[model samples]
Target: MRVGKKLFPYPVLNNSKNNSGFGDSNYQLMITITQNENYFIIEKAYVEVENQDIERMLADGRAKAIMVVECSATVFREKYEIGIEPKDISIPIGNLNDKVEISSFIYANQDIEHFNSNDFLEDFADFDFSIEKYDILAVDDGYTTKVVFDEDKDKKMSSIFSVIKSNNKDLNVMTVSSENKQIVIEMPSQYFDYHDNMKHNDNFQNIFFAIIAIPALTQCLQEIKECFSDVYSMDINEVMNDKTWFVSIANRYQAVFGTELTSDEFIDCNTYEVAQKLLNCGSTKAIEDFYNLLWNGRSDSDDE
Candidate 1:
């Protein structure tokens, strides 16, 4: 499989002087795009303000500023249509000059199941096969990258495994532990081989391609973990402590992302550390933030 595109380097903005009546301060924003199959994911969008700017903004021990990142996409057809504009997703910047990274993805209608399975298939069933691709536009730092994915096929758990196995014949497949759970395959040898080759050749493009493909299998593994956890009345943490349980988690991660974890990568790490690292790499911050924002109150503060 060909790696799609190389992301451009981040553009650094240095706003130091008052131009056209704005403030006179030195601030920098670096924005970069990271692509996956269906999403134009934002790898890093960080803003840095000078200490002087922070000091100037801080008044009465409180300095509140909102940093917004808005995203939009376009769907092309006989009649071109623009997708809904994403909310003014804002993050609060306190009185600190430290770089704050904001990460998100621009998802197309095809990213959703209803659109992919029904709407798109019905609308463009007869069009030229090549022209049926949809584009997802991600706007960051006044630059946009159009991410394209084919709407003809749904990228299910089975399809992903088929592709991987077809590409690498040495893959040793293992079934997920839970019945009724989605298929989570393991290819420890193949994973190691791919990583070694990437390292040897120093192919960052292939490395990123592997990174993007991982989330697909990870989703399947997550379902299996949840099912197993519920059936056994054990937390993921407890399950991960045991070799079998750790293998299960690792298999799930590998299935989705096409990367196998070394024993050092998972077995050595504590439960919380492993979970945190997984959350960070998997782009599951929205789930964490929702819980923190909505349910965490006075009792939550006490627990913290």
Candidate 2:
């Protein structure tokens, strides 16, 4: 989220020069990233330019906005094209363990002779000059952001877990595990393939989460209860403090119930109630979506 002034060698749009009549308000760059397990870091990037001259240049291919990303941890660096239309980008998440630095700039797409802009400084505003290709015209402040691979309590279920095939023949449906913060749902190979194929459907997503997360959360709460059966003697922080998964589930319990997870109310609650609270009664939504899918057949078109 870096937004500030940057120094450039050439006379470009910036906040420094007096009478430039151009500043950050005239140009802006925005970038957002989403982590997809260990596969790729997806980026949605775009730039905003208020100046009509710059907009015309971009529209006619005289100028281009570019996003420059660098990750020291992974030793990865790459440049991407960006503009008014949002750009979807993906970079392989290979050993990407630390902060990623991102910077953006608008560059001359080709040589421009007699470049003149009403937004330019007084001296340059009326003068026409030759600008070489690849010359920087505008720059955005640089910043750093991190990508997390571990499943903390703050992350969503999608980020916290992945589905994989189970080698065990006796296992029927699915089982959950939160190992090394890479939570996984393991099922028999056949069921695993089915789950993978159908999990992307919005309706199936709600149903799958209900079936897997509820039971997993219930079992997790039971472990906490067994380990600290005496609520009075329980120090919530001390119980499974070393296990991130345990701490995450405990935090979720408190989040849902609005009380310490080791409190008497939590201890007295039954498995069903605990599941309901943990999921915030997610099953209700599942049922609603299920009925919609069955009756509506997933069509958004109105019958004219």
Compared with the true structure, what per-residue lDDT tens digits does model 1 show for residues 194-296?
A: 7446533322322222343244344444554555545655444433333223434555467645777553343333444344343333224433433555676
Error at 140, model 1, angstroms: 9.8
Each prediction's whole-model lDDT (CA): 0.33, 0.65
What does the lDDT read for residue 188 in candidate 1?
Answer: 54
- List runs of model 1 lying over 4 Å from the truth: 1-24, 55-61, 65-67, 74-142, 153-304
Off by over 4 Å in 2: 1-6, 14-25, 148-304
Steric clash pairs (candidate 1): 214-256, 214-257, 217-256, 218-256
What is candidate 2's CA lDDT for residue 4?
A: 51
RMSD of 2: 15.9
